[model samples]
Target: MAKKTTQATPKAAENEQQSATAQKPHILPDRVWLVLARRAYEEPLRQVGTVEADDIELARVYARSIYDEFAWVEMALVPRETLVTVIEA
Candidate 1:
């Protein structure tokens, strides 16, 4: 007696793939945002702190609300994920 093996058809394989993909958890982009602020005109922007949000607008809101204690002349938020490091410590 010999063992028998079965192979899935192309459509069945595709359906299985699709089902597996659907069953996997949907991963969302949660990023740490770097907050920078300048106190006055001609002042260099400095990193104040970081904020966490899923998108830029939400990050901006979070940064402003969290760091609003200072009378900053300007403020900006950049997703830390987009930054490239030139030097490593």
Candidate 2:
């Protein structure tokens, strides 16, 4: 007895490739922005949340919209990639 093999049709193969591509995670530049907020001028800025955006404008909008739980007097967005880990515990 011989083993049987089946071949996929061109259309079905294309569809399978497309579905595989869709299922794979997209490769995008590091766009994670760390959201920092301060309750008062004297208070130190604390990490509140993070947002992913392609640009600073979008990051600003996302940070404001997503982290609206508190009425922070000052809010800032810093690119996570630029942050240098001084000490890692």
Candidate 3:
């Protein structure tokens, strides 16, 4: 006859999660960066996607890696905070 073993209970898992979170300090939320790119010289730059990053350099790296679907002629990153609201939506 084979021996039977018991699986971990939900309470035990919850305790482990609590301890893990307690050990680490709270972190600030990442800033949102708007990605804009233009495929051709004649075309206007359009918003392709967005990325969350700690700084501009990291944001640039993330934008390039995640939005590599196009061979854009020009690419730019604008911080979400800098944009002005011309029209309320």
lDDT of each: 0.90, 0.90, 0.94
* Tens digit per residue, CA lDDT, model 1, 5-89: 8889999999999999998858775789989999998999999999988878889889989999889999988888789889976
Give candidate 2's whole-model lDDT: 0.90
**In lDDT terms, how accurate is model 1?**
0.90
Kindly give the stretch of ten consecutive residues in candidate 1 with the minimal lDDT sum. 23-32
TM-score of 1: 0.64
> 2-84, model 3: which lDDT tens digit per residue?
98988889999999999999977587678999999999999999999999997899999999999999899999999998999
Count of residue pairs whose backbone atoms collide, per candidate = 0, 0, 0
lDDT, model 3, position 68? 97
Clashing pairs in 2: none
Q: List ranges where model 3 is wrong by over 4 Å.
A: 1-26
